[model samples]
Target: MDAVVIGAGPNGLVAANALADAGWDVLVLEAQDTIGGAVRSAEVIAPGYVTDLFSAFYPLAAASPVIRDLHLEEHGLVWRHAPSVVGHAFPDGRAAVLHRTVEDTAAGLDADHPGDGDAWVELHRQWTAVRGPLLDALFTPFPPVRAMLSVLRTQRAAGLLDLTRLGLTPVRRLGSENFGGDGGPALLAGNAMHSDLPPDGAGSGFFGWLLCMLGQDVGFPVPEGGAGVLADSLRRRAEARGAQFRTSSPVTSVTVRGGRAVGVEIAGGGSVRARRAVVADVVAPALYGDLLPRDSLPAGLLRDLDRFEWDGGTIKVNWALDAPVPWRAPGLAGAGTVHLGVDNDGLLEAAKDIALGRVPEHPFLLFGQMTTADPSRSPAGTESAWAYTHVPSGLEWQPDALARHVDRMRTSVEEVAPGFADHLVGEHVQSPALLEEWDANLVGGAINGGTSGLHQQLVLRPTPGLGRPETPIEGLFLASASAHPGGGVHGACGWNAARAALATQRTGRRLRRALVGTAWERVLRDPRSPR
Candidate 1:
């Protein structure tokens, strides 16, 4: 085979498709009996309801150039959006809803506070001014040289220093400084909490602002039928391009010869050779320690992997409701995604609890109304809904404790939607262990491959001096969420890896391999150096 992809997740599928599009022979091996990793959906909650097992909304996917350029829509992928992108409900039954248009969203915020709406409009203006280049920088490879230059070129059009300052600001401060009301601040802080980052953490402002702006640009959309439909669309596109897939095939380890990846060893007792490359869509720990021989990796690289930080653990609950969620706030009814049961202070408190390794009494819930986004998710008048919350990483999650945490999530939802539980016809809970069992990439229930914190991001991701896909081993590449740009359904990691492999093929192999090895060695020599 020209390339052997170790996993059949979205990233792996994207990689296979890219290599195949390049006219390279490609084979994808999946450990699961079925493909789609976290992007798959099923009717486990109820006979008529299709519940997304992991992720539901796809703002990132909708905006991703890599995913969009694939034209998956041509392969039976239809995007559907709810009337409202996101809704945040207050305790007093009032809500802040993000509409597709800036005017509508600003009008809603203006109702909360007179001048806050104008402030929101200005924020969106700044985002719009630089959205293209900014997104390019985000999804591009590390050092993002050309993308950064594009962003710099916009300095005259948009205030470069001001954007830089805002990007580095904490979400808490970003909100307080920009708006005069709860609506604006709640939206910013709530979106920031979507990740492992607390509202006060550095760079939280950028994430929060990015998501909020994306909601305006492209509504938080979903597949017309189910999330699995999106995965299937990608699969169909790859297959049309002649990429082969093998399910129930687990690659136990990557075989190396003379410091170059040659093939992968299957679990039972077989091996598949890769003439060109082996793209691994697994997490960092599994690749660095479990799959590859330890002696093949530099001792310094192993030490850096030891410090690899994973984001918080996650617990998801899926429900098939007999009726729509009886949200007390009328505005929340039409939103595809909802952030509820927490205000600015409550979000901070809950974050602190999770940081301290204690489950919060009222965990903030990221609830999704699948039926709202796509009516086909369930039968007429019924709803398919799910909610998830994060807990501290490395918790035991014993039976009783897990149940209590799940209850806390339910009760939190009930606070905003008075009769939420009463409408449920069926319920399915995915604990941290269950999540890991389903997809090993979600290690310790972490949806993001690794922490999105500043310390572990950029060139420091996976390990210092290695954020791009090319690994220490020749013909080997890391194409999982653990790679650059962290976690999202964008498929940039896979795109970068495949492009890197193609670039190496065009260039001479020995010279490129020697240069890469020397670069890693030079940067890794000083463990304390951030560079």
Candidate 2:
């Protein structure tokens, strides 16, 4: 193969498609029987009820230029926006809804806390000024030096200073500084919880701003059929461009020669050569430990891998409900997604507990009513709801323990949304271990690959080096969510990796040939013996 992509996850598929589009003969290898990894839709509970295996909502899908330019809708993919972007409910029966329209959302905020309407409007206005440049900096290949320069040039001196300050502050501090009301802080904290980070963590403010602004700019929407349909469409487009997919082929190793990746060794002793490049969409730790030979990796890289912290694990529960969740607050019944807890303080407490390796008594639960978002997800008059909560990583995943936790989550939701547990017709719970088994990228149910903390984001992602998707080894790249731009179904990581690979291929092909003899001699004469 001209370019071989290991793991047919969304990022892998996107990378393969990009390579194929650039006229490379691409091959995608997947360990599972199905092609899509986390982006899968199946009738897990009932015959007709379809549930998204992992990711359901796609706020990034609407905002991703790579996905947008692909015209996935033309390829049988449709997007359906929810009536309200999201809802955050409190224990005391108070709820706040973020609407698709900024004005409406501001009004909702004002209703909740008297003067928060103007505060929200001001926040949105500030976000609008920097949103384009910020997104461009994030989504595009890094060392985003050019994008940063452009942003600096465009914004006035004071605006630039404000942006800098916003980037540095934690979500809790940012909310406190920007808006005085409880509603503003609650909304900001809710948005920040989308990442594994706590609201008080450094740089979490950026995530809060980014997600809330995205919700306002483009409501969190799901694919018409399910999240899998989006992947299917990408597969179709890639296949049309001459990309080949091999299912159930798990890669065991990436074959190296002269310190360069030459091919991959499959689990069953089969090998496939990559004539040009090997793009791995797998998580970083897995790739280094399982796929590559230790001798091939630098000592510094291996040491850094030891320090890598996978994000907290998740316990996911999907339910086939007889009816929509009856919220104590009536307006929340129509929400597509809901964040349930007491308030911002309660949410922070939950996050703190999870970080300390204990499941919170009142876990910050994120619930999605798939049927409300897209009616096609369930049978008529029925609803499909899924809820997930972050748990400490590396915890033993026992079925009985999982069931108990599920019950606790049920009770938590019921406290906010009355009669929630009674409506469950069928339930499916996936423990962290189960999630890791399903998709290796979600190592121990760390959905975002690595923690979205300040040290692990943007340029420092996957490791501190060139953030432009290139690896130290020639013709190899990290294109997974572990790379720059982080997680979500957006193909930015893959797209950025493909573009980098193309650039490297253009320049390195000739340069590599010239240095082949010297490189081989150096490889053979190395003092380090192969284990």
Candidate 3:
């Protein structure tokens, strides 16, 4: 094969598709019998209900350039959105809703904070100016000169500095500064918690703003039937392009010959030789620390790998409800995704609990209403709902303790819907240990691949100076969330890795280098540049 992608997760599958589209022979190896690592959906909860077992809502998928370019819709990928994208429903029956258009969303915010409507519109205006290029800069490789230029075309250097501040701003500050109350900030904080980052952390604001804006622009749409449909579409596209997939074929190691990745060794028996590239859709620690031999790695790189920290754990619960959640805040019933029973203080308190290794009694919950978005997820008059929250890692998992946590989580939901428990037909829990066991890629249940804090981001992602996907070893690249642009359902990491791998062939690398180098030189010559 021209390329051997080790792991048939979204990133790996997308990378294989990209390679095959470019007319390369690609082979994708999967550890499990299925594809879609954490993106999988199952009827694990009850009959007639298809719940997203891992990742349910996909704002990133809706906004992804690669997913758009791939045209998965033609390949049977349909996105379903609720009337409202996201809602933050507090205990007091006050809700902050994010609608499809900025105007509608702003008007919703105005109810709590007067003129906060204008603030939201202004934020969206700023997002419009640089949204395209900002996403390009984020997903593309480091030193993305073209992306930088695209943003500069719309925004001045000062505006760029402001954008940088959005990334550096704490999530709490971002919400408070832009609006008058906790409604807006709660919405942002809830979304930011999708990462391992705390609301107070730097760069958490970027996640908050990005998700909030994306939710407004394109509601957090899910596939019609289930999340698996999206994965199946990706697989079908790849297969049509002549990519081959091997399920239950766990790769033991990358066959390195003379410091270059040659292929992969299968766990039980054979080997798949890659004529060109070996894309590891696995996490960074597993790639550098676990797979490669000691001598194959440099001391400095190993030390950095040792310092690599995994994100907090997660406990997910899925339910088959006889009816839509009877939210105390009636507005929440219309939203596709609802964050139940919490405000900013509650969010911060949850984060603090996770930090302190104490399970929160009233855990802040990220609620998803599957049937609200897609009726196909359940039978008529029924709903498929799920909620998940982050927990501290390294705690010993006992079945009883996990059960207790699940009970608390259930109580958190009941706090919102008041007698929501009476509507449940069936329920299933996925603890951190169970999540890790389900998919090895979800190491320690750090779903975004790792903690996406400021320190772990940029070139320091995975390790310092290693976020570009290209590794020190020839033919080997990080093509997963462990690479740049940390997490979410977006396939940017895979696309970027595939592009880098393609660059390794022909004079593509040289051409790209020349283009970037020219841009760098021009920027260096600019007196007003921040370089």
Candidate 4:
């Protein structure tokens, strides 16, 4: 094979497809019996109710430039949207709904609070102006020259400064600074909380704004049949381009004859040699800690791995509901994704409790009404609903403790939806342990690869000086969610890695030297970065 990809997740498959398109012989090795790491769907609870066992909604997937270029729709992946993208339910009688269009979303807010509509529109307009360039910068490999030029071309000093501030400020502060009412802020906070990030966490504002705006621009869409259909589409595209897939073949280690990665040694005394490159789409720890030979890693790299931070653990509860959740606010029923907030202070408190290693008394919940987006998810009028909440990653997880957290989550939901508990015909609970058991990449249930916080992002991602995939080993590259532009079903990570590998094919040692120099300047030069 010209190249071997370990793990058949979205990023892995994407890289494989791209490599095949570039005329390379690509082979994808998946650990599970099936493909689709987090993108798989199954009838976990009931026969008729199809549940996305892991990742359900994909606003990022729609916005990805690579995915758009691949044209998955032509490959049988049909994206279904909800009438409204997001609904933030509060203790008040009403809820804040973010509809498909900014005007409609703002109008949904305008009816309850005067001028809040205008506030929402103005922010969205600002988002609209830089959105194209910002998304380009976000999705592309860093030192994103084209994306930065796009940003510079679109805006002058003030708007660029605003983008800077948005990147720097916390979600709570950004909301407070912009809106007078809780609706807009709650929406931002809820979206930001989609990761394990606290409402006040740095870089959270970007997540909130990006998701909320993207939801308005491209509704929080799901595949018509199932999320697995998405994986199938990517697979079909890759296979059509001549990519081979090897299922249930786990890579035990990267075979290193010299300093360069020659190929991968599979579990059960087997091996697949990559004639060109080895692209790993697993987590950083699995790539560095378990797969690669320890002697192959630098002492400094080992130390950095030791201090590597992971995102908080998550608890998801999937329900086979008798009918759509009858939200007290009524408006929430139409939204595919609903967030149960405790207002600004309440949200902060929930984050605080998780940070403090205590199960929250009032957990902030992210709800998904699958049938709203795709009716085929369940029988006739019934719904397949799921909600997820986070906990401190270090918290010792046990069955009894998991049960208590589940109760807390249920209570949080019941408080807003009134008789929400009554709608549950069957239930499926996945704790952090169970999530990891399903897919090793889900490490400690840190869904977004790792923390979505700024410290672990950009040039500092995965590890300082190693963000763009090319490792010290000549033919080795890291393309996992742990890489730059961490997690989500977006294929940026693997694409970046594959592109880097392709660069090596073009420039060989010269490109490696250039990449090393680039990494030194971008990473090692930082005074705050530990050597």
* Per-model CA lDDT versus the true structure: 0.89, 0.85, 0.85, 0.87
The candidate 3 region of ten consecutive residues with least summed lDDT is 522-531
Candidate 1 clash pair list: none
Expressed as tens digits, the lDDT of each residue in 205-290 for candidate 3 is 98888888898887799998999999999999999999999999998988888867899999888998998999999999999877
lDDT of 1 by residue, 268-367 (tens): 8989999999999999889989999987787778888889999999999999999999998898999999998788888888899988988888788899
Instruction: Tell me the spans in candidate 4 whose CA falls farther than 4 Å from its real position.
Output: 517-531
Instruction: Give every collision pair in model 4.
Output: none
TM-score for all models, in order of appearance: 0.98, 0.95, 0.95, 0.96
Give per-residue lDDT, candidate 1, residue 135: 89
Residues 219-262 of candidate 4: C-alpha lDDT, one tens digit per residue: 78999989999999999999999999999998999998767788
Model 1: CA > 4 A from native: 526-531
Point out where model 2 deviates above 4 Å.
510-531
Cα RMSD of all models vs. native, in order, equals: 2.1, 3.1, 5.0, 2.4
Query: How much is the lDDT of residue 91 in candidate 1?
Result: 70
Q: State each candidate's clash count.
A: 0, 0, 0, 0
- Root-mean-square deviation of candidate 2: 3.1
Clashes of 2: 0
Tens-digit lDDT track of model 2 for 1-531: 898999888999899889999999999999998988889989998877889989998888788888898888777998897788888898889888888889998898888777888888988998888777777887898768787887987799999988888877889998888676777787788888889889889878878888888989988999987888988999999999999999999999999988788999998889999988999998899888888888887666676778888889999998998887889988787789898865888888998998899978888888998989999999888888899999899999677888888888998899998887788899998899888899988988999989888788766788765555766567788889999888888899889988878877877766754553234334333344332
